[model samples]
Target: MGIFDFLKTKKVNDETFNSSQFQNEILAFALWKFNETNDYYKVEKELWGIQDFDLSEKQIKIIIEKLKVFNEKKN
Candidate 1:
């Protein structure tokens, strides 16, 4: 391996870290919205507006389902 290869690896790692961080931010916002409104459709629309990444329908449903379970346990 060359010395420059480490730079490429670091870039990939940074991108992965940023992506996960963004996901966490999205989930946090979604959870807060869900807790407040208990309306997944509104949360989905809000998330779609704020995100830079392409969030699929399945992913949105999964997040909403998880949030519902979480809210149920908290109550």
Candidate 2:
């Protein structure tokens, strides 16, 4: 703990805040599209940038579950 440590800490917090804000923006857009079309699959696939991914079955199931929960909450 010394002079300028606060600045370093603040910088990390700012970066984390910015990242969270950006993620929220993307989620808002995805949810908006989902509400319009009721297409969580497309929203997850396209908006999540997983169209080209080859995820394992377990990973996909987890993703689907998360999306379902997200959609349910929105509704």
Candidate 3:
């Protein structure tokens, strides 16, 4: 491999980075909403509105699980 080959391979796609950042933003918003309302359904609904169905079921479930853990620790 050339000396610069590693540099090319190490570069991350902007789209992928933005997608992950967006997911983190969604998670942060969901957590904040849940903390404020203490209602999972409300937070889910808000996330749906913000994500506009972009997030998959698995992602949603993971967010819900995190929220549950956060709630437990909070109590």
Query: Which one is best on lDDT?
Result: 3
lDDT for model 3 comes to 0.68
Task: Give TM per candidate.
Answer: 0.58, 0.42, 0.58
- After TM-score superposition, the amount by which residue 5's alpha carbon in candidate 1 deviates from its true location, in angstroms, is 26
| TM-score, predicted candidate 2 vs. hidden true structure | 0.42
For model 2, the stretches where C-alpha displacement exceeds 4 angstroms are 1-18, 48-67
Weakest 10 consecutive residues of candidate 2 by summed lDDT: 8-17
lDDT against the true structure, per candidate, is 0.66, 0.55, 0.68
Per-residue lDDT tens digits of candidate 3, residues 1-75?
Answer: 888855542322346424867557767888899879989988877765653335545566767887787778978
Candidate 1 per-residue C-alpha lDDT over 23-68 given as tens digits, one digit per residue, 9 for 90 to 100 = 5775788898877877888888876665345565666666677677
lDDT of 1 at 17: 30
* Candidate 2: residue 35 lDDT (0-100): 73
Query: How far out, in Å, is residue 64 in model 2?
Result: 6.9
Report the Cα lDDT for residue 29, model 3.
83
| Pairs of residues at least 3 apart in sequence or in different chains that clash in candidate 2 | none
Error of 3 at 72 (Å): 0.7
Better model by lDDT: candidate 2 vs candidate 3: 3
